[model samples]
Target: MIHEKFTKDSIISLSNLTVIKEIDDYTIGDEQKNIFFRVPREAVYVIEEAEGHNTIEEIQNSILQNKKIEIDVLDFMNTLNNLGVINNISLNEGHRNNFIKNLGKLLFNKTTVIFYIINILLTIILLISFPNKLTPNYQDTFVLSSIGLSLLLFFFVSWFLVFVHEGAHYLAVSATGKKMNFQLSIRWFWVVIEANMNTLWSISREKRYIPFLAGFFIDILIINVSFILILIINDIFVISLLKMVALIQFYKIIWQFIIFLRTDFYYVLLNYFGVSTLTKGSISYLLRKISSKYSLFFDQLSIREQIICKRYSWLYVISLFAICYLFLFFSIPTVFHTLKTTLNILSAFAYNTFEFWDSFIVIALIFFEFILWIIAAYKRFKRGD
Candidate 1:
């Protein structure tokens, strides 16, 4: 009856996972290789209709007014969960405003040359004291144990780096006689330390670039130093930690391709495009313009997005779909793999005390992403035409 019920079962899961349907909401589209159930757009409408009082049969029968739901109804329900678009509870409006408000509050500091020097010394000492601290192969070692240690190392070190990076932002703002507030923000499970220095409007682009680039600078310096240590050190602990840090730096570069995420990379692209929050806002602005003379939907849209829909609807729509797919499969894995790898290292360090929690945190992060996605999409939909 319930969607979670279907996930708990076997046959229903394997048989009809994703329901592809026509844009018109009647014809059943092609089914891709179904790893999990993907709800149809039609089902989304039905679910909305059935939110509280409507029965499944009634909803299904309604959708089938002219055409039937060829896939299993329960399967469709489970698919909603898989796609992360549906849930038992009414979805909470995501923290879109919090994100914008966080701009000034989200600045972070970076590691200076001195920090790198100390890190190098520590790595050298560790390598010298124990040249052959063997860690278990992932295959031979228990999955839970390996995963657990990996998580612990990742959590601590990752947090440490974030703190240092964010701290640099805070200090920079402070030096200018401006104060900031900090928060742990998530952009789809990629942990970001955000510091708001909203008062930094008068700050020069050069000053702004320093705080933005500081984190990666520290990460790059640390990573290269790790590579130097790796040239001699035979220990898994030392090598893995360094590798993890380097990998994180590499992962952040995805921000370049995305043209969003409010990273330095994104800022570069936005400036080039002559837009703020360029990608998401573009399509909606276009849509509003195209539809204003034709569709009432455009009339009801938010003023900002209405402007976007008018200005760049066609381009915006294409980019929207393109970026969404890119973010989901590519960006998601890149971050998770880093998180997973980091966790594996930490688990090794901690002897895997909280394996369950490690898995939970990872999964929780994955779920949290959809909310951000919604906020972004909503903003795009509401951008000035």
Candidate 2:
């Protein structure tokens, strides 16, 4: 005889993730860290047959009556137990629901949406009214009168703006009456606030779109508000600072369109087309094409799925081109310019002067950022992700 512990509240359902091929996609879920464990269809049958009290042989006998299945009962039990999804402590739904409701109350509704629309329109109009302030003068705005202080200032300001951006996403998710989790982590050498996307799956697709897009909307708001503030502010230092922040916000807006990065727009595109794994599928197709080998990448899909992939592939290629162009045209030039300016400043100032120390700080920051980039890249490579 054998005994097993499995949660009565455990869910076995189709996965929300989009896949390349049409296969039976199922996931097991419990209240464990909002994570789901995906398994084969046969595993679902095994779980259903287990029923906690039944011995492994008894469960096997029941399943075998209908079909032959080969699953190591011990291994299966261990996996679920380790995942804390089977026979785990029950979640306090009442407390969770109450928290979600409280958060939901803070979300923007129709009336608030209307107000936001009006503000957004007004902001655009204001931006169009001020053409000179749109072009960024990084030196005056970011460097201030002191070069040494610039990197530290830039880091803090950028962090604040990102906090606001992520906060917008949090509010958007809350508005949809979904639970959200946030983590501070590094991505591509930059520290970023990561919102748990798994929580979004419980909500409507349309509702999910806004949460993903909320950051970009906030970025636009930042830019527009900076422009407005610049008009009223008399201080050159303040104006220059705001202008630089505005330019950074503007660059963030452009960053959203790089769909190859699985950016906010990437999610938008996926939701709009009602497809999953579009980017991965497109890349595979492109790779096959490059090898002068036609594969059945599209033929395996349903006609509708085929069309989505076919259309999305071109956009994926376009995103790749945009990334290359941005790196070569924008990134390289900025790095070169910054390095040259820093070197000049360092040369002009004596080692004992504040200016030299300032230049040294900027140089140190540059090296630190580069090191972070290398660490991130190496980790990703080792993980084969």
The C-alpha local distance difference test score for the whole of candidate 1 amounts to 0.47
**Clashes per candidate (backbone, < 3 Å):** 62, 3
What TM-score would every model get versus the actual structure? 0.41, 0.73
The lDDT leader among the candidates is: 2
> Model 1, which residues run further than 4 Å from truth?
1-145, 175-177, 189-191, 268-281, 284-385
lDDT of each: 0.47, 0.64
Model 2 Cα lDDT, one tens digit per residue, 201-264: 5444556667787777778767878888889999988887887797678667766767776678
lDDT of 2 at 194: 61
Residues 41-159 of candidate 1 have per-residue lDDT tens digits of 75545544444454555555656774665435555655554654443444322333443335433433233535645654655465466545421122211123445455445556656
